[model samples]
Target: MSEILRKGDIGQAVADLQADLRRAGYAVERTAIYDNGTRDAVAALQGATGLVVDGAYGPKSRAALANFDVSRLMRESDLIAAADRLGVPLASIKAVNEVESRGRGFLADGRPVILYERHVFWKQLVAHGVDPAAYAERTAILSRQRGGYAGGAAEYVRLASAMQIHAAAAQEAASWGAFQVMGYHWKALGFADIESFVATQYRSEGDQLATFTAFVLADTTLHRALKARKWAQFARLYNGPAYAENLYDTKLARAYARFAGEESEAVA
Candidate 1:
């Protein structure tokens, strides 16, 4: 390898590589430099692929780069537009969506099922003091909890159901949408009256994504998940990133391509 590499080539490659690593739950930097972080990412990739653990960027590394797709990184254009309407940051929306359905349609098996077992949804309801029953004996409690306690459940479940998880709250059905909301917790977060809020704020579906993004970005759980770079752990925190990766295989690649631009980054 040459002492100096093409920054453009390196950046583009690194971005693509890093996107692949990210999809696999590896933490990688988006910079184009061949820094220590990049080396560690290379080593981890090599180990995962059963290749030589040399950190040097060479032919093997180049070939291996093909395995890492940079096209899956999050893009903020849509989220940014949504945030502008919602008065939030684009990063916040993108983060939550990344955590959720990875910006794809939700629902288990592409059907109208609830996606989680009744018991699971029940448990989540218990946490927020909101009941999913057809009728609520006490609408007052439901109302109080519905704002930031019970909203977004229907939509979340709808998305997860499309993904094909039988039980409403099973591990497989844990996550939903681009925000990967778990059960009724999303409603508890103040999105319960999304229709009213959207109307009041004059927003759209993009606002919903951005609002959720801000919620996740502000959450300690999400922050820790990003810092640890533990996709599996984080997935469980929301839903399963592994399952999500499988679900959004092609879409995620497109997302990376759309967001990463021409940068070359490696996935860990």
Candidate 2:
């Protein structure tokens, strides 16, 4: 009871923590050891309960579990449905999910994940009838050069400021949810508009999967590459031309193997 369990701590205490987390309907494994999954679940619980989200099982985290609810954030059925919708193996979806989101749709504070793109914001300002040159100096939120990222919930600060300048364009400029689809793709992704797309984002991870599947299905090249397991082709379409430099395709192949239970040609 005196020890604080973290990402590497192991033993009966860790196992108990896993059980309690699972009981609360978090997507955690009872592996008898504290790992990333356990830490993320703990962090989510802390965020939901207004405790400091340090991904550690401390005294406060222990106390919060006593009043926890079994409000699961996602379900197995959702994954199957998404894969079915795409006519691909569940592993394909899972591989992309893991690669893009590290298997988390929401952040520590129960907000859907987002990344504010300065370059996208720069373009968005122009689309919204604002002078990009005037706000180009606000490089953190609006700029032609793509390099300012606050990461995690902190990115919302950037988004908020951009919203003040141009609300619709600001929202369109950011990537959202587990699949990290850019808001600009709302119409083509089947959403009525950016607000509709954003609304679904705040709903649940299941909805996020829907957005991802829609994105994949909408693009013939992307869908073909994913179904064929052509990692490099899919990576280029999804992550941009610099995907190889980031080893995104390599990661996709390896991640797909982990979920698909098959060896990757790239790896083996």
Please provide, for model 2 over 1-268, each residue's C-alpha lDDT reduced to its tens digit, 9 standing for 90 to 100. Answer: 4457877888888888899888889988889889988987987887787653446676557767888532334444676788899888877776776576545678877788999998998887788788989866677887778878988999999999999998999999999987889999998987888999999999887788888889889999999998999999999998898998999988988877766653232146
Task: Give the least accurate 10-residue stretch of model 1, judged by summed lDDT.
Answer: 140-149
Model 1 lDDT at residue 237: 52
Model 2: residue 53 alpha-carbon error in angstroms: 25
lDDT of 1: 0.43
Question: Which ranges in model 2 have alpha carbons more than 4 Å from their true place?
Answer: 1-72, 262-268
Per-residue CA lDDT of candidate 1, range 1-268, in tens? Answer: 4432322346666666556656766677767565666667766665555443435444444545566422222233455565464443333334334435433322223321123333444354554464446433333222223222233346443333422322323332233333444434445556554233333122323434554555555577755653444444555555445656554434333433433432234331
Taking all chains together, the TM-score of candidate 1 against the true structure is: 0.34
Q: State the C-alpha lDDT per candidate.
A: 0.43, 0.80
Q: Supply every candidate's count of residue pairs whose N, Cα or C atoms clash at under 3 angstroms.
A: 60, 0
Instruction: Record all residue pairs in model 2 with backbone atoms less than 3 Å apart, i.e. clashing.
Output: none
